[model samples]
Target: MIEEIRIQNLGVIGRAHVQLGPGLTVLTGETGAGKTMVLTALSLLLGGKADPATVRTQAQAAAVEGRVVLPADAPALVRAEEAGAELDDDGSLLLVRTVGAGGDGGSGRSRAFVGGRSVPQAVLGELAQALVTVHGQADQARLRSPAHQREALDAFVGPQHRETLGRYRTAWAERARVDTELTELVERAQDRSREAELLRLGLGEVERVDPQPGEDVALAEEAERLAHAEDLRAAASGAHAALTGDEDGGTDAVSAAAVVEHARRLLDQAGTHDPTLAALATRVAEAGYLLADASTELGAYLEDLQADPRRLEVVHQRRAELGTLTRSYGADVAQVLEWAAASGLRLLELEGGDQRIEELRATRDGLDASIAELARTLTLGRAEAAQRLADVVSQELTGLAMAGAQLQVVVEPADAPGPHGADRVEMLLVPHAGAPARPLGKGASGGELSRVMLALEVALATAPHDDEARPGTFVFDEVDAGVGGRAAIEIGRRLAELARGSQVLVVTHLAQVAAFGDRHLVVTKSTSDGVDVVTESDVRPVEGEDRVRELARMLSGQDDSQAARTHAAELLELSSVGR
Candidate 1:
């Protein structure tokens, strides 16, 4: 709850410090006397919009600060710490906002701090959103939106729909996830099929070519031989002719083998006469045998040296096929083979799209079913709680001076599921008999709307919440504007009752309302010199004679009048708060 508020050079107030505690504290003053400035200060601390015009004429900047105490483990506390805010030793949070303008004619800029650390305004906004709700005429406009209506109804329903709301939220989240994945898969279906087809075509090409490892290198060597076949054959035949006489039978040439044979015969005839000559004959005979064996092998090679055009053509065709495979698939036959092996596994996975799609569809269908079930459950829970809420709030309205107010919590089905549920909840009002029932958004007056919200808050305070935690402060910035008489008194009573559980601060002009304040603060303007030379507005806590004087002034604009004093004294006696 807010412990204190400090304002410096804001609006008509030069400097003010308002100490607060847990209860209904009322701020009252004459028109334009700066009672609203106190609320403006608190609003600034709550991250409300900043206006340069709100700054005092003599001040360069306007600043508002608030001291709030929260649980140590609260989410706001954690976020403030994350933003590097230093918490008080007692775990209180310091919230501050300042709006400054340049000395020249320039627009103003604003800054915010949480727990004494400078932070973005948005961080302060988030913390304020969690801490307090400021209800006034502006918020009455917000009450007209259908989304807000649904939110109010949900909050009123409380723990009744917590479980089903949780389930619906989970199912809805899963549905979104599955839907996204399924959409992606379907969108890529054609692409995967095209990819699979290309893989199959490439693999088929490789299969048809059937190039073996190292085949390219081997084929290149074979092609070289075929290209120079005639040249090779000629060279071989010439060498053979030198060893033995050509097949053309040229007897004029003396062949190497024939000369060796003649030399051996001559040596043998001489070796018969002398033993040394016989040894020379044996050596010559060995030379003749070696020459004869080589000549025979050369003759066979010459016969086999002829090349065929058909064989060469076949080799060229095989080489061309291997070349095509090498260029498209890989630089070498081995690499191409490796690609084919990997492609086979990839192809299997790509074609498995159908199975994956089916699985997703199955999961999506199950999620759809679960979500529908949860929606139905949430709707039933809301329907039950809505009736109970209507009855309770209707009772509260009766005490707030609307005896004939009838509230109807309508649970209408939505065409599609929403984040909250499948139903759109609206609060309908029938002000009296013969008054047609209309949505509170359209039918209720400003006073009635205030009471409606107050009634809802009261009912919800008693209802169990999922966490059973309440906001730190309830700020009613003259939400009691259009209410009066007993109705105003009831509003005060309810506020005082609410303060029993949490902090309540109200800016009101009604004495009936101000009389119920546990602490009363009156904003008064002090004048200097004659006529309207200058004036200053000051706000401070008042009690005893000062409080009676303020209440008397609020009651009849006559603080010294005995009749007003007597009435104010009676009001004090009648008030429930200080009593």
Candidate 2:
């Protein structure tokens, strides 16, 4: 609820500080006394458009500030914190808006601040939804809107119905998703077929080659060995000859094995004379054995080495085939094999595209059936709630002095399902008995429309809802525009009733309405003269005799008249009885 409002240089309100509190607070004054400027200040705080013309003459700028107390878990509070707004020491949010005077008589710029931190005007607008509901004469047009009617009926049905509506919306969204997927699959059937064909061809080529994990590397090694077989054979033979001197004893030099054996015999003969000679003989014998083993291995290698052109050509052809696979698919045989495995899986999926499409269609059909059922459920729920709402609001209209009027909340089938439902809800008014039901504003006067709106609001508020769903403050701008007498009193009573659970601010001219206010503020205008004459307006709360005089002024335009004061006191007394 708003705790206070401070406005400066705005309209006729040069500087005014209006203190507000819980319950119904009414603003009243004589014509041209700047009562409307109070609400205009509120509008600025609500992020309404700013007009430079609203800036007081000779003022550089117009500014409005508001202090609102909100619940700890309020959505508006959460949003404000998200925007880096800080709460006051008393836990109230401070909102401020300023409109600069345009230079050279052009349009001016507007700025908004929440909790002392600057924010976008749109942020203020977003917070306004949960902060207050403002009803003006122009809002009668909004009441006639079909969408708004649906929303009103839904709100009246309470949270359980809203949960049902949420379920239907979720199901509808899922159905849309399924339908989109099904359509895409059907439209791309030929593309899937072509993809499958390409995968199959690639797999066929890979299977024909039958490449192994390391085939390319192994083949390259074998090819190198075979290509140099002659050189390998010749090198082995030369090494063997050197190790054994010569197998045919063709060299004049002694064979390595024989030379070592001779050295061992000489050392043994001298061992009888010197022990050191015996150790040398043992080392010479070990060398002779190692030379014989080397000669045997070399001979074996020479025997195994051979040149085969046919085998070389076979290895080359195999390498070329693997290269072909590598060029298109991968870098080598191993990579090619990996690609084959992956493509095989892809081929399976592509081949099953037709089956998958059919499965999707089946799923979509099931969802369609479920969605249709939920839509019907929503329609039925709304229809039932509409009747209850109409009954209640019609009763409200009766109390508002439209004794024979009736409210008809009509629910008709829509052309197709929407996110809301498959029904169009409209509120029709029957001005009196035996009269045709007409859409709101069709045959109803401005006063009747105002009553209908008020009745609807009261009826909706009768339903239980948490604070988040119901705003804490409501502002009415002349809701008693064309209303008078008992009807005006009923309007005030309803406003007071609405305020039992929230804060209510009404801009009114009727003393009956003013009498119902828990707090009354009156705007007074005066002209001050100095070097230049200046007109200023101030808003001050009235009480006791002052309130009575203000109410008298509102009633008969003569505060000193005894008859008017008596009537004003009587209205106040009547308004107090029910409280």
Candidate 3:
């Protein structure tokens, strides 16, 4: 519940503080006394949009503040904590909004703070939704929308409908996902087929050639050696002739190995006289052995060398095949291998596309069956709730001087399922037994419509729903507009009855409504500094003689008149006795 509201530099209200409490509180004043500004101030505190034009002429900024009291475990407190708001020591929360004009031509900006902690303006808006519901002339207009009508009906149906709605929404979301998958798969069927054909062709070519890792590099080196086989054999034969005697050639006189052997023998024969010569002979003999081993290996290499054209042709053919694959796939053999690995995975997905489509379709069908059953249950629940709501609202209207008014909540099947359910709800009203039922807003006077809306709210409030806390405060701006006499009295009584359960505030010009107020406040205009120079609006609680005078002023536009004061006193007296 909102405990207090303060406004500074908002509209013509330079400064005003309204200390509020529980039950029905009424604000009344003469035309243009700025009684509406109090509601505006509360709206600002609730994160409503701020208009720079509403700022007082000489003020650089406009501000509104409010104190909201809630239980420790209330969802609002939870949300506030999530937003880093700190609660007061007494557990009450303070909300403030300031719109600064910068005292320049630049457009003004608004800021919000909750529980003394600065937060985004949107956070304030969220708390406001759970804290208050403000109804103005705009709300009466919104009641005409079918969408709003359905929402109202669902709210009236209580927690069962809310649960059903949650289930239906879950199914709807999953069905949407399945539909997306199915559409993608069906749309890309031809594309996948084309892609699969290309992959198969590439795989077939790779398989036919069956290229091995590192095989191409090894084959290139071998082909280069074979290409110069004749030159290689001649070079080895020359080296071997220098190492040992060449049997095929007579030009070579003595081989290196034979010369080294003679030197080693001379060294061995002189080693007995000089020990240094023995070490020299051993080194020469090792050099001679190395020369002989080199010649033997060189001769074997020349024998093994081949200059066959057939093998050379085969090597060139293999290189050409590998070149075709490398050019199509990658810059090198390694990169082509990577392409083959990745393409295999992609091909697997493409091949399974049809199977995936089948799986999604099956899942969607199963969900459809469940959703259809849930929709049926929701429709049944709505039909039952609608009947009870209409019956109770009719009973409430009878007390509000609308004895003949009949409210009908109609539920019919929708062409398709929605997030809420498969039913379309419409609230209809029958003025009397002979009259056909029409929509609530149609064929009804403004006063009659206001009573209907009030009755609906009362019915919804009295019934227990989910633990989700509703706004503890309700504000009505002239819902009694275009009303008078006994009907006005009934409206006042109903407002009081509503306040019995929660706080309610109203701005009114009717004395009958004002008389029912547990606390009466009056907004009066006065000039500051001098007469007729500058006017300001003042809001203050009225009691005793002052209350009677204000009520008299509302009753006959004459607070000083003897007859008006007497009537105002009588009205207050009767209202105190539940009139």
Give each prediction's root-mean-square deviation over alpha carbons.
13.2, 8.6, 7.8
Runs in model 3 deviating more than 4 A are 102-107, 202-342, 528-537, 577-579
Question: Candidate 2, residues 337-433: lDDT per residue as tens digits?
Answer: 9999999999888888788888988888887888788888888889888899999999999999999999999999998789899998988999999
Clashing pairs in 3: none
Tell me how far the alpha carbon of residue 448 in candidate 2 is from the true structure, in angstroms, after superposition: 0.7
lDDT of each: 0.82, 0.87, 0.84
TM-score of each: 0.71, 0.70, 0.77
The number of the candidate with the highest TM-score is 3
lDDT of 3 by residue, 1-579 (tens): 899888887776778888788899999988877777788888888878887777777678888889899987777778888898888888889999988765576358888999888999888888888888787767777776668888777887778778878888899899999999899899989999999999888877877877888878988998998899889888888888877777654436678888999999999999989999999999999998899899899989988888988999999999899888889987767777788888889999999998999999999999999899999988888888888989999999888887788998889988878877888888888877778999876777677777887887798788768657357788999988888888788888888988888799988999988889888888877777553111223678888899999989998999998999998898888685223
C-alpha lDDT (0 to 100) for residue 55 of candidate 2: 88
Q: Which order, best to worst by lDDT?
A: 2, 3, 1
Measured on C-alpha atoms, candidate 1 has an lDDT of 0.82
